[model samples]
Structure formats: C-alpha cells, structure tokens
Target chain A: MIEGIATLATLGFTLGLFLALAARFLKVEADPIVDDITAMLPGSNCGQCGFAGCGQAAEAMAEGTATLDICPPGGKGLIENLAARLGVDWDFSNSTTNTVPMLAYVQEATCIGCTRCFKACPTDAIIGAPKQMHSVIDSACNGCTLCIDVCPTECLQMVEVKTTLTNWRWNKPLPLAQLPLAA
Target chain B: MPKLSIRGGVHPDEHKLTNEITITRVPTPERLYLPLKQHIGAPAAPDKVIHEIIHKGQIIARAQGSVSANIHAPCSGYVEQITDWAAPHPSGLPTRTMVLVNDGRELRDDVSTPVNPLFLRPEVIAERVSQAGIVGLGGATFPSAVKLTLGQSRNTPVLIINGCECEPYLTCDDRLMQERTQAVMDGIQLLAQALYGPDTIIAIERNKPEAIRLMEIACKDFGNIRVMAVPTRYPMGSEKQLIEYITGRQVPAGKLSADIGVTLHNISTAYAISNAVRHGKPLTHRIVTVAGDAVKRPGNYEVPIGMLISDLLAFCGLKEEPQRILMGGPMMGQALPHAEIPITKGCNGVLAMSRAEVKNSTEHPCIRCASCVDACPIGLSPLTMAAMLKKDKLDQAVDIGLKDCILCGSCSFACPSAIPLVHYFNYGKGELLIRGQQQQKDDEIKRLIQGRQVRMAQQEKEKEEMIAKRMQAIAKRKAAEKAAAEQNSEKEIA
Candidate 1:
C-alpha cells in the first residue's frame, strides 16, 4: 500500500509540474473587458461602427478610444446598458439620432442583381440568384444595413416591422379613469 | 353529502341580475363589422369571398386551414370594403373585418327548414355543422366540428356537456337552458348523435338549480343522458376544472383533456350544434347578457355576431356613467377600450360597470399571506410566480406552472393586499409568447448565417481550385510547345 501510494504521489507531482509548465507556456493574451463588450454587440459584423469588426470595436471601446454610441443598429437601448455597465454619465440630449428597430426591405421591381448586396450582407438575409431579383428574409435580418450601401440599383430600404393581429398584444392596460372615450 | 371535489376557487358576487329575463331580439344595426379571426385558428381568407353579393346565413369567408372555422354573414347587405377595424381585444388593435351595410331587406340567400337529426349519419352531421360555421358558443369559440370529429375518433366513453356558467354577471347560458329547454336538449342529443357516444352527461353548477332541474327533467326520457350538479365555483366552468370535478380525473399538464379519454362540450355549443344540424341554420346570432349597474335595462339579448357594443348598449340605455366596459363576466372578462368594438362569437356578456360595480383596487406588495396560493384553482403559487415574473425570470415562472394557470382572477380577488396577481400572469404570458417568437427568429437567423458562411467557404475553395487547375493547364501547354520546338530544332540540326 505504501509503494502504491508513493507511486501515485510521484505521478501526481510530475503531472502537476508538467501542467503548470504547459499552462504558463500556452497562456493566451486576452482583455476580458474587450471579450465582454464583444459579446454585448449585435455580432452581425456589418462594420457600420467604422471598426474592422465587432471584436475591433469592442477593443477600441475597452481602450477608451471609441465613442460609446458607435453602433447605430444597437440604438439607444444598447447605449444605456453600456453606460450602466461602464458606470458612465449618459446625456440623452447629446444623441441627436434616435433609431427604431428596422429591417432591410427589397423592392423586387428595381433589383439589379449585381450580387454586390448578397456579398456584402453579413446575415445573408437576402436570397436570390445572380442576375435575378432578391428579397429579404424578415426573420434572418438584424437591420445591419450593410447590404443597403452595396445595392447598385438602390432597391434595398430599411423599414419597421408591421404589426399584425397575431404579433399584437396589450401594452400595459391603462387605469379605468384614463380610458379614452369611444367615438 | 360528499365534499366539493375541486379546490381553490373564489366566491365573488355572482350579480346574475338578468337571470330571470328571457332573451329579447335586438334590431339589426345599420352597419356590421365581422372579424375574420373570431376563433382561435388561422384567419379566414375573405379576399375571394368579397365582390359577391352577401346575404344572411350565407358563407362570406370559407375556413382556410384544418383548424380554422368558416364565417357566415349575419344579415343581407352590400359589402362596404373589407378593411382593418377595431378588434374586441383589450389591445384595441385593428384586425381584418368585413363591413356590411344593412339594406333592411331581411332576405336570406338560402332559407331551409328544420330536418330530423336522428336520420343523419354522424359524419354527415359533423360535415353539416362545419358547413354552418358552428363553433363553441361558451366563450372558447373553438370549431365545433373539429371537437366533434376529435371526440368521435377518440371513442371517448362518456361526453360531459358543460352547463356550469360560473362567471359572475353572465346568465346567457342559464337563460339558454331555462328558455330553450328543448332546443338546448336537442342540441345535446344531436352532439351525442354525432359522437355516437356510449354515455351522455350534463354538468350544471348547483348555483343554477333551476337549469339543473330542467335539464334533469329533460334527461329522464333518454336512458343514456344524466344530469350531475357540481358545486358552484369560479373556474368550475373551465374545461380542466369541470372535467376534474365531474369525473375525478385531472388532465395531466401539457396534455389535452382527450388524452385521458374525456371530451368536453360547452352547453351553448351543443345548442348551436342542434340548430346547425336540425334547423339548417348557420351561427349568425348568439344570446348575450347586457348587465351591470350602469345599464338601465339588464337583460339577455339575442345579438347578431357583428353588432357593435355601442348599439347594444344604446338599446339597453344607460342609467349612470360607466366606469368600465367589460366584454365578458366581471371575473375574467377583458376591459374594453371602447364600446365601438364588435361582439364576436366568443363574447358571452357585455357589462357597462358603474363606479360601484368596478373592482379597481390599487395594487399592493405581497405580505406572504398565502391567500393567492389558497385561491389558485390550478394549485400554483401565484405569489411565487408573480415574484419571478416581476424579476423577469420567465423560465423560472414557467417551471413553477405559469402555463397551467387558467387566469380565473381568483388570486387577484383573494389577495387582501389587492395585488393584481392574474394581471401579472397575463402580462407574463404575453411577454413569454413574444419572447418565444423572438427566440425562434434568432434561431432561424443563426441557421441562415451558418448556411451563408458554409456557402461562402465552399465558393472560396472552389475558386482557389479552379485557379490552380487553370495554372496547371497553362504550364502543361507551355511544356508541350517547348518540347515540340526542341524536336523541330533537333531535326533541323540533323
């Protein structure tokens, strides 16, 4: 039993030393804050924020070089969340542009089908063959607007999603006294 | 006597003031707005049905899907353009509605007389019910034909007709049973005939003893039909609760009542079924109760399906200013945004409540009193679910039986602190549904992105391979030319 214990002890010590050496040698250099910020991004890689990608934008934000409101698609909600997380003062008045949730719409009549929009689209929401008309998939689109700039015929446009009976729901009901008089 | 089987129900004031009043027919309104989605399925495609002259009892919109129900024109009129109009929901959003102008001709497209229901085959009866656009008139509004077909296929041993109109201030079903005794009974018989059932039973709440007595008297002739009076409770009218109270069988969570070999039919649904099968009539009109302290005349009215609440209320006349207008019983009915909304097939009652009648309690924090827990009919802890929902922990709330809640408003009624527990549940349920739709969208987006990435990589690889092949071919051609030139040079030297 003593011999077996000694063997196990030696084996454990050797493996522990080897693991320590390996961990030290194979350690990856990373900024955790940057990674966290990257996860918070919309991740469409549309590059509307003027950064190389979501990762680069995250890196710039982490280094205090990039403005907090760089992401147009993220809109006001993302900025408020970021401000809360970063413990920064946010002035709502300073932001001139207010963005609502938008989806890319394709005008089938005018589509040139140069394949530029599809090549530019990060989500590949646009479905079409070369030299044919393209249409946007409502569910697949994240409203990145990357395809809009590339469409040569300017067929693509951003639009708010239409509310239907199936998707509609009660917005917190008003008290009885506040109800509008029916005409 | 045996104790009441089902537990955790509130005994709110019934306020059945119009119980004794017989159903009065309301004059047809000038304009009617019939919504396409009166039932819980795919909206009827009325695009093609338009342009044709509409008449009373004529099908204006055919059932589009397997789960959908047909929509019939209540009265004869010219189509005034199909458009989006105010819906009956609390949201007040516009839905697709068929607008018809009353010509006052009272002309029906095809008026057929009553036929003997006993001679018809069960399948034929179901088909006729479907053609007549019959649906559950007990506020559920599920397609009656679908339920009949489902019940018939299951070979369910016994069928329980729900006469337990437990909602307060709603006596339409009671009035239906008391006045149209033979009609309701005939409907039940017709439904049973469609099912080819082994046994038929009617369950009426003890509160409606008159209805019970009459139904019992009606059942004496038929050996298969029996009447059982259950304890009058708030949610006893619910499918699951009633099923449990009568048969002592709890429908397992996330499963249909039919899975347990039980199929339930609402009392009014049976009545409508009888009319469709025998009278050769479509469900164009239904009995509705107009009551509350604000109304001068609180009585049951035979209302057309597409009649606006404004016209109905005006006919009833107002005694006082209404603090709130509810479209069903006070307990579980939705507060109407306005009286201009059209009454659909599912609307059983319209209550123009005065200040004295409105239950507008200010919400308070829970005291951990466990009152909500005791009041919950589905045996869920409303307090815990509310707390979780407040914290936006939807999955946690769902894990604790949020989906099982019948939204009877018992917890809200039972809470001493006046916490709107049911309201929270409703909002939570709505938010959960929206979130579920969003999650589905996200998944679909992810799949499309992955597919795009794969296609891009394949294109890149293919392009590289093609370039490599072209380079190799060019090199081979160059070597062949050089070899041929060397042979020519050697031959000339020789």
Candidate 2:
C-alpha cells in the first residue's frame, strides 16, 4: 500500500511539473481588449472584414493594423461600440455606409443544373439535387455572393428584400410632439 | 348567476355608446375595395376576371391555401380593377385589392336551397361553411370552417360561444346577441353538432345584462347549452381567457383550445354560421359598431364587406373632423392614416375619437413598477422584455417568454409612466423574426461552403488518381519497349 501511494504521488508530481513547464513555454498572452472587441463584433465570420474571422479582425484592431469599420454586418453599431470600448477616436467620414440586406435568387432558366453555385454557397440556402435546377432559399441567404463567382452559368443574382408588414415596427414617436401645446 | 373570473386583466372605461341602439343596415356605397388578405394566413387568389360583371354573393376570390378563406362580392357590381392599395394593417402597407363599382341595380345571385342543418352530416356542414366564406367575426377572422374541422378531428368535448364584447367603445357583439339571440343560439347548436355533440356554453360579461338575459332565454331550449355571465374584465374575450373562464381549463402555452378538447367561437361567428347553413346565404355583410365621442350619431350598422371607412363614417354623421380614426376597438385597433381604407371580415368597430378622448401622453421611462406584471393577462414581464429589447438582446428577451405575449394593451394602459409596452413587444417580435431569418441564412451559407469544400476535395482526389494511372501506363509501355529492344539485340548476337 505504501509503495503504491508513493508511485502514484511521484507520477502526479512529475506530470504536474511537466504541465507547468509547457504552459510557461507555450503561453499565448491574449489581450483583454482584443477579447472585448471580438465580443462587440458580429460573430458571423463572413470574411467581409478582410480578416480570416472575427477573432483575427479583433486581434488586428487591437494591434492598430485594422480600422473600426471593417465589419459589414456589424454596421454603425459595432463601430460605435468598439470605438468606445477601445478608447479610440474614429472618423465617421471614412466609414462606409451600411449595405442593404439582400438575398440571392437563382434564375432557373439559365441554371444549367451545374450544382457549382450550390456547392459554393456559404449558407445551404440553395436547394436541389445533382443535375437538377437549383433554387435559393431566400430566408437562408445572407447575400454573401460567395456562389456568384463559382457559378459557371452566371445564374445567381442578389436581390434586396424589403421589410414586409410581418416585420414592420412602429418607431417610438417623438415625446415633445405628442404632448399638448399651450395655446 | 355564478360569475367566472380570470387572472391578470384590466378594466378599461367601457365607452359603449351604441349598447342600447339597434343595428341599422347602411346603404351600399358606390365603390368597394376588398383586399384579398382579409383574413389571417395566405391571401385569397382573385377568381373573377377584371371588367366582368359580378353579382352579389359571387366568389370574387378563392382561398389560396387550406388556412385561407374565400371572399364573396357584397353587391352586384363590375370589377373595376385588381390592384395594390393601402391595407387595413398597422404597417399600412399596400396589398393586392379587388375594386368593384356598384352598377346601382343591387342584384344578388340565387343562393343554394336551404336545408336543415341538423339533417346534414358534420362534413357537409363544414363544407357548406367553407363555401359561404364564414370567418370568426371577432377581429381574428380565422376561417370558421378550419376551426370546425379541427374540433371534429379532436372530438372536442366543449364548445364555448364568446359573447364577451369586452373592448371599450365596441358594442357590435353585445348588440348582435340582444337582437339575434335565437340565430346565435342556432349557430352554437350547429357548431356543437359539427363538433360531435360537445357541451355548449355561451360566455357573456356581466356588464351586458340585456345580452345575457336574451342569450340565456334563447339557450334554454337547447338541452346541452348554457349561458354564463362572466365578470367584467378587459380582454376577457381572448380565446385563452374565455376557455379558462368557461371550463376552468388553461390552454397550454403555444397550443390551441381544440388541443384540450375545447372549442371556442365568437357569438357573431355563430350568428353568421346560422345564416349560412339555414338560408344557404353567404357572409356578405357584418354588424359594425360606429361609436366614439366625435360621432354625431353613434350606433351599430350592418355594413357590407369592402365598404370604405370614409363612407361608413359619413353615413354615421361625424360631429367634427375626428382627430383619430381607428378600425376595430381602441385597445387593439389599428389607426388608419386616412379613411380611404375598406372594412373586412375582421373589423368590428370604426371608432372616430375626438382629440380630448385620445390621451397622447409624453412617454416616460419605466420606474420598475410591477403594475405591468399584474395587468399582463398572459403573465409575462413586460418591463424586463422592454429593457432587453432596448439593449438589442433579443435572445435574452425571448428566454424571458417574449413569444408568450398576446400584444394586449392592458400592460401599456396600466403603466403609470406611459412606457408603451405593447409597442415594444411588437417591435421586439418583428426584430426577432428578422434576426432569426438572418441567422438561418448564415447557417445555410455555412453549409453551402462546407459542401463546396467537400466537392472540390473529391474532384482533386479523382484528378490525382487519373494522373497516377496515366503515369503507371506510361512506365509499363516504356519497360515493354526496352525488353523488346534487348530481345532483338540478343537474337542478333546469337
């Protein structure tokens, strides 16, 4: 019993010592600000920000290599939030206008049943079997246009979708305008 | 009378001015614009040809899907146009509408022969109801045929007739019950028969003693039916609340009343069914309450479907240029930008309120008072939901039961700070739907990208295998040529 306990203790101490050494040698000192910026960004990983993903974009921003208005999906909200979090002064004039939300539509007549665009779509918005005319599921399309370049028939087109009554909302009326005016 | 009460409701001021007035049939208008999407679900497809002369009660639009209802012509007229116009929705978006011009003949098509509803099978009754385009006249406008089918399928044990006209300034249902009690009761009996002899209960609020007396006397002839006067409460007419009050059964959240072996129909819907089944007449008109302080003459009018609100308001005689014109009751009605919009199957009231009656209060921040919690009939936290929505944390708001909200204005009315709680919920629901759709798109894009990668890798593997096979073939041919050359040299040396 004594020998077994001793061997186990030795093994545990040795493994713990090795883990401590490895951790010290391979430690990645992640900047807290980078994490905070990443948290502020839309985690879509759409690569529209010219980075591999939102994490890389956040890292570049922390290193002062990337600007605040890099994410298209984040829009003005992310820029404002990120600027506040990073304590940086951002130029609104340099910021690009937010792109209108769009969905991809496939022209069925010219689709050629290639299935090339279907494979390239980042979202499985396209539905069809091999050698069959493919159609885009409008609700599932992010308008990333990833399928546009891959389509041999050039049948994929992006269209802007307007908000319908199902998604329409009443903006809060101005408070002063609603109050009765003194005659 | 034993009175039933529900949890978490508000008693708004009952400004029912037309409660004592009888229903009057208004003269047909010159033009009627009927939006195809009069009811919930898919909009009906226009079946009549443009410029064709259509007789009254002719099918103008057929139901596009199972969840939709047919739309019949209200008066004999020529189809002027089928175009888009501002619909009677809160968003005021343009929807496809069929405009008919009255030829002034007031001609109606010959209806089917009247038959005893009791002699007909439940399926036949349901089919007849569907053909007549009868819908729930209590603001929901769900096709009554669908409900009947569902009740029959579930073998529901109880049928609740909603006579609780609880909305402020809306007395159409109350007046309907008082004037056509026997018709309404007949409708209830027919619906019960369709639902396989379910116990029928007509629930009316205590505020309308006249309607209760009439309904009770009318129901006495039916052995299985009972008329119960429930306590006066705002939104007691809601399907969930009514089901609970009548049967002491709570319809589980995100479920229908039929799921719990109970079916509820509006009193007006029952009355419409009686007319449709007994006389073989289609639903061409409805009783609309035109009441408010701004009206010179406030009373219920039996107005034809597709009549413009402006014509209805003019017929009622407006006392002044109304500050606000709302379709349906004030609590849950949509304010029309102009009076040009037409009435549909769902419209129960046309309230033209004076400036004094409209409380355009300056909205104040919520002080964290729990009055909204007490007023919410569905038992949801409006304050927390509003706060989460303001922060744009929709998932968190949904986690706190945002989907359970019925958009009742009770919380908004009870809030002392005037937070506009219902507006926030509406906005939140809309935003959630948009975001959910976007997320679905993102997921689909990811899947497509993954599929592309898999396909490319497969192609690359196939190309590598072809190249490997070609190289092997080339090597084998070269070795054979070398062997042949060596054999010739050996033979020449010999």
Candidate 3:
C-alpha cells in the first residue's frame, strides 16, 4: 500500500508540474469564442446592444454576463445559435422578444437639410447632399437607432417592416394550447 | 439497370369522385383577377399602364427571365387595376394581381395560322413553346420550354409522361387523358422529336384504366411511344417516383430526371403543349377538378386562368358552407381562407370539403411507431426531424436530409396519432426559408456597413488632404504677394 501510494504520488507530482509549466508557458492570449462570436455578429458596431461594440458584446457573452438575446440586431436566430454553441436550452418559442423587424423611415417633410443622421449611420443607408433632405434606403437600413439619436430634426423613426410578397412568409402554426377549442 | 423501388409511401382512400365525369366549361366572370406570379421563377411582368385594354390571347405580361411564362388575357377586357389581392394560398396574403374586367366579347389578337410543328427544328419548337408560356400543369408549374431545353441539353434518352393523378379527390389529369388523347399523343410525339427521338413512356396509374386504355390506343402508330400502367400508389405520379417505377432508376437529390438521361412531363402539360404548338394557343385555361362532398356538382371543369373561385363555385353550386376549402388536391393542397381567390395555371383541383370529409383529429404526441418513417416517399425521418426542430436544431435537421423532403404529406396521412407531421415539416421549411432570407439580409447589411466604413475612412482621408493642400496654396500665395510688395518698396527706395 505504501509503495502504491508513493508511485501514485510521484506520478501526480510529475503530471501536476507538467500541467503547471504548460499553463504558464502556453497560455492563450485571447478567448477564441470571442473571435467566433465577433465573426457571427452583424459587425456594424451600432452599440444597440448596450455594449461599446460587437467585440465588447462578444466578450461579455463569452464571460456569461450578457444574454445571447441582448443584441436586438442579432435577432432570434443569433440567440438560438449562441445558445446551441454554449450548450444552453433556450426556449425560443416562449420568448417575448418576437419583435417585428423595424426599418429606419425618414420623414422627408420634417427633415431640415441636416447631414447628422447620415454621418451617424453605420450602413450608409442615408443618401443626400450636406444641405439636402436625406432618404434612407429601406433595404440597407439596419435600424440601429444611432441615426435616430444623432438626428437633430428627429426625422428618422423606426417603422415596423411592411409585409410584401417578397418578404412575407407563412405565419407560424399555433400551438395546441393556443389553438381554439373545436366547436 | 436495377429497379429502385419507391422509398416510402401511404395508401389514402382514392376519392376519385370525378374520374368518370366529362370535362365541362364555365362562363367568364365579370372580373377576373390574374396574378403576375402564377408560374415558378420570376413573375410575368406587365408593361402596360393601368386601364390599358387587353384582348383575349394577348400577351398582357411577358415572361421576364429564362425560367418564366407569359400571362395572356383569357378574355378581352380592360385593365381594372394592378394591385395586391387575395391569392389561392393558405396564408391568405395579398399578392400583386392584375384585375381585368370582361367586356363579354372574347376578341383574340395575333392568332397564328397552323404550321406542322414536326417540320420545325427543335430550337424553333422551343421558342414557340416559350412564347406560348406553357408550364407543367401537374401542380409543379415548371416552365415547359425550360424543361424541354434542359432535356435537349442533357441528351435525355427517355421521356416519361406523368398521368398518375395519385392525389385524392382530383381527377383532372384522368379526364384530360380520356378526352384529349390525340392531342396529348401528338404532344408526346412532338416532345420526343424535340428531345432527339428519345424513347417515350406514358405512365398512367392502374386506377385510371380508362386513361391508360385511351393513351394505349393513341400510342398504336408511334413506334417509340408506349403506355404504361404503373401502381396506383400515392405520389406515384411524382417525376422521380414515376421514373423509378418505369425506368428502374432514381433521380439523384438536387438533380433533375434529365441528369439521368430522362425527361418527365405531366399529362395536362402535354395537352397544353400540343395546343400551343398546333393552334398557337397560350396557356390561359386548364381542366380543374371541382370535387368533394360539399361541391354540388362534383366534376372536372375547364377553367379560365384568371376566373375567381367564387364564380366557379357559384356555377357548380355548394351544398353547404364548406368546413375547409382547398385550392389543390386534398393531400398536398393549400387550405384557402376564402373563395375570393383566383385560379392560376398550376391549380388542378378545387375541393370544398365538409367536416366529415376533413377528418380534423386532435393532434397527439408521436407514439414513436415509425409510421412516418414508412410513409415518407423521400425516405426522410419526419419524427426525428420534428424532435430536432423542437430542440431548435434546424441546421441539424437540415444536415439529416431535410432538404430532400418533397412535402408529400404521406407521413401525416400514415400517422395513426394524427400528429400533423406535415404541418411540423411545413413550419420547419418556412422557418428555414425565413432564416435563410434573414441570413442573406444580414450578409447584405454587413457588406453595406463594411463598405460605408471604408468609404467614410476614404472620405476623411480625402478631406484631410484637401485641407492641407488648400493651406499650402494659401501660404504660397501670401509669400508671393509679400515678395511682390517688397520688390515694389525696394524700387521706390532706389
């Protein structure tokens, strides 16, 4: 029993020393997950997720401090993806954030030839000359609200995306509980 | 070649109510709402301004892209308006539609005289077919011209005509085969020649012995054409399934039958092609089986493309308020919200079912009986896929052959639990599509953002450079002015 214990102790000591050396000498400088998350993110750096940027948001997400759904721009797909990656059982069906996709609409009539909104736009969705009324390209606008805050004229507003034949999809089937009882 | 049997299938009660009924005709309605996107690919685009008059057989909207069909006026009518209107879909959403008001006179324009299509070259025939805007009437709605071109390009060795109206409560194809045998045969012969004299087989379901008999009689003179009576199984009419049953071959996933040196066309499509080539007729009308218990007159009707379902039902007469109204066959048909939807080129059946006909069972949890597995014609695991979907693992489900699903509804029909397996699949497919669209939008946004970032940086750099250049020029001008002033002052001092 003494010999067995001595041999085990020696092996443990040697292994522990090797692990310590490896930890010290071969330590990773950055979390690989942060980079992966940054790649998946919108990369717009719109700061709508309450973080300084997507990189910071990814850092917080990696550290488990930020929920996957914290970024509105990422949408439900991102949440599900992140949940899957992190091995979390995210019940997306019951999620309250069934937010209708919003598009930045420009109130052209009220807009005073201010280039501030365009300057703040991350996607260059706004188009106009410096002193001319600006218009947002519906397709390109990310609805980040950065332009909204910077808009001195308050011309930019988030409008729910109107359903067109191209963009519209079949409504999801109602759950059994939600389905009305047969007459 | 070894026979690749149908992977999985279900035997639903073949409610061939209108199988023996002769084809009938319905009068033109007051207003016909024709949708732009009746066929697959890009929707037919109208170049006319609002209120423009369109005559019968006039090309109101031309096919925009390679894989599209032209939309012709079924009746001489003035354009009422082009606006979003109800579509014959389950979603009940409005799509871009051209409303035409019938003037009671069907004045056709540019009616071409008959030319023997057999004398024409294959490419010429293809051009005429594309101009006629004929699509597969087998509910697939693939552009017939495009399919012909594909067959020609692939050097197809066999041509299989799909006469299997395997869907329950739909007998439009059967009726067409029984009535228009010669035209369909001519179409088959013409198609065979266009496809470089490929061996032709008209595959009809054994259930429709009449269609089979008629087709066989018509194929007597054609040495290459043969009428085949295949098993009357559900989805036996599917191009892949029919090819498998007759040719003993399997069309690889993500590939057409042409890839395997074969081409398949529907019976209705063949008839349409015959009409288009012989009479120079555009695809403006189709035989629709208006059946089910609720319909007063359960028979097949040759319906105008833009005619409203309400008008058709008014002519047929409904016995009572239908519990469910479907635009196609009951098995794979869409449950339409109302009867205001207009008929399209692809629609084959208009079923107004009662509660008894529609066996709406309470959805029960899967019993893990694997009935769904047995019923899937594509041999996909509907149960396991559903489980993955429940876990929100859509990508995982896709990995396990979700893309091959044909939405045949055989699994749901086979399920004893009435679990609505097809509904789950529909949901999954829609979710995947939506997710794909979202991914595309995200990618587009990312590109735009990156481009904007680069542009902003370039603009800033340019602005800085412009400012520095202006400052240098101002300083140089000031130095030159000072030198001139100093020279003038020195002159005065001298």
Please give the RMSD of candidate 2 to the true structure: 8.5
Candidate 2 clashes between residue pairs 3 or more apart in a chain or in different chains: A122-B445, A122-B446, A123-B444, A123-B445, A123-B446, A124-B444, A124-B445, A140-B441
Q: Residue-wise lDDT of candidate 2 within B63-133, one digit each (tens)?
A: 98899999999999899999988889866788899999998897887777655788788998999899989
List, residue by residue over B167-239, the lDDT tens digit for candidate 1.
9999999999999999999988888888885488798888888898898899899999999888878888999
Give per-residue CA lDDT, model 3, range B392-489, as digits (tens): 67888899888888889998889887877777777788878878888888889999888888888899999999999999999999999999999999
lDDT of 1 at B237: 91
- Identify the leading candidate in terms of lDDT: 3
Which candidate number maximizes DockQ? 3
Give candidate 1's whole-model lDDT.
Answer: 0.84
DockQ of each: 0.22, 0.25, 0.31
Candidates' interface RMSDs, in order?
4.6, 4.3, 2.7
Better of 2 and 3 by lDDT: 3
- Which pairs clash (backbone N, Cα, C closer than 3 Å) in model 3? none
Q: Could you tell me how far off, in angstroms, the CA of residue B481 lies in candidate 3 after the best superposition?
A: 2.8
- TM-scores, all models, native as reference: 0.81, 0.78, 0.92
Which docking category, incorrect, acceptable, medium or high, applies to candidate 1?
Answer: incorrect
TM-score of chain B of each: 0.93, 0.90, 0.97
Stretches off by above 4 angstroms in model 3 are A1-28, A85-87, A93-99, A129-133, A170-183, B1-5
If ranked by TM-score, best first, what sequence of candidates would result? 3, 1, 2
Better of 1 and 2 by DockQ: 2
